[model samples]
Target: MSDTRLKISLASDRGMIDAALVVLGTVAEHCSAPLELHFLGHGLRDEDRDRLAHACDAHGCALVLHALQDEDFGDAVQVNENIPLVAMARLLLPRRVSGRVLYLDCDMLVQGDVAELFELMPQGAALGAVRDFYVLDQMRPGSERPEKLAWHSKVLGRSEVEGYFNSGLLLLDCDVIRSDRALMTRMTDFAAANDYRYMDQDYLNVLFDGRVFYLPQAWNSIWGRDRLRAKTLAELTWLPDAERTPATSKVIHYTGPNKPWKSQSKLLALLRGRLPALMKWRRAASGRYA
Candidate 1:
């Protein structure tokens, strides 16, 4: 048992199969830790499973499938949404007494050693998330609506909430997560009751308010229009480069409808140029060493 090696998992429906594969390929290339990929939800068809298995074999990583039982949440309802799938996946993952498990969304791509995130784990927190940039109390001129504001307030659990987090990436202490079913139940209940503004993110903010450790924005950078308008790729400090490569990024979350796989993102194009070669080298290295 290697203490430094971490177990990582992703939750996704069938629509994210390609994204998940891309994410896995990226992780296998960049991370030096032992990796585990779990597929949750109904969309994981047989063909998808076979493709995932082939990818895992190519990288010498373990891939497992744990179908969510209706009994797990006491509901026969199937959750195809990313937010709820994320929450349910964390709650149902197999427990490990000592090692850490990092839960990443399918939309993310890794650029560095994710094992480093385990070392930065806070003492009492069961999970960690990066703050979302769009969580503002005062809505933009055209975006403001009383109902929307009220929904955001309820989702955040308060109107004056600080630093709303993006729930696409999470680092969980397996020991704490396995034992904290009560908190998981509470989160589920909150999601069921609230017409959440941001789905799972809203539930997480309301449940783990002020408890989750705030990591650097680089960990889950949103590559949307606003970020591009605020700063160009040259000005973006988090991008890996000759002089300023990130020392502590565990994952790179591509949150929102826009993703690197799509043709619209300039940032994705830049990353795609670099990530594939790295992935190929890692695959060869793993074959030789593992």
Candidate 2:
């Protein structure tokens, strides 16, 4: 029983397998603590799983791959046009992993010691996450899409002042999560009945609602949002601070469709002035260790 061990969970569709590898490689490089990585994915080819096992072995981390079933999540696994069905696998993490688990989306690249986050648990909070600035952006007046923003309050059963949290990075107390069957049932039921713009994120906001412990923006800094700091400040609460730039950010969430896994030139264009940070993610995502 090593005190420094961190349990991590990741869920990916077949298409995002490479993205998963890059994330693991980056964590292997930067994370100072030991790790136990559990991956929940559907129909992963043997070779890819073998490769992931080898990657984890090289990093001195243990890896487990669980075959995912749609039925396992009930109606909660319903399709979302915005995200792959597998992305919802995070919903099952507490039931599957058994103890405290850190759930990270495959699209993210970590640069700091993840152990720091793994050790933190807010008093009496079921989940710890960063606030979703996109929620605030959409909720603001004068935004073109009123319908999307309108649901935040309706779905969460609270006002926007309570804040909506990003599901990309979560530090979950699995014991607490497993104890609450009603919360899980409600989230699944909500997912089945409603079509949400942000997919499982909406359900999580509704599930955790006011209970989420908000972590700092540096912990789950969104790539595009952090870069947009030069443009305006009012709507971007998720932006990383000047001192906690990409180099210092513990987690850089490559949110949205334009990812660093794209070709170098394309990434350069997409990231524009933020290429230096993009270069780091690109290198990690590509598995170019040299």
TM-score against truth, every candidate: 0.69, 0.82
The models' CA-based lDDT, in order, is: 0.58, 0.71
lDDT of 2 by residue, 1-290 (tens): 45457888888867888888777777778787788888997778888788778888888988878888767655554455547778778877776777777888887888777777755565557898877756555544355355666677777765544368889999998788778888756644535534666677877876786677777657777675564432333444444453233333678887766677665575565546556567767766554521
Error of 1 at 90 (Å): 4.0
Off by over 4 Å in 2: 1-4, 75-78, 137-148, 158-162, 187-194, 227-248, 263-274
lDDT of 1 by residue, 21-119 (tens): 777787778887677766565446788788778888898787667655445554423344434443445545434224467777776667677766666
What are the runs in model 1 whose C-alpha is more than 4 Å off? 1-4, 69-88, 94-99, 136-151, 178-181, 190-194, 224-251, 262-290
Report residue 244 deviation for candidate 1 (angstroms): 13
Worst 10 contiguous positions by lDDT, candidate 1: 239-248
Candidate with the greatest TM-score versus the true structure: 2
TM-score, model 1 to reference: 0.69
Candidate 2 global lDDT:
0.71
Residue pair clashes in candidate 2:
none
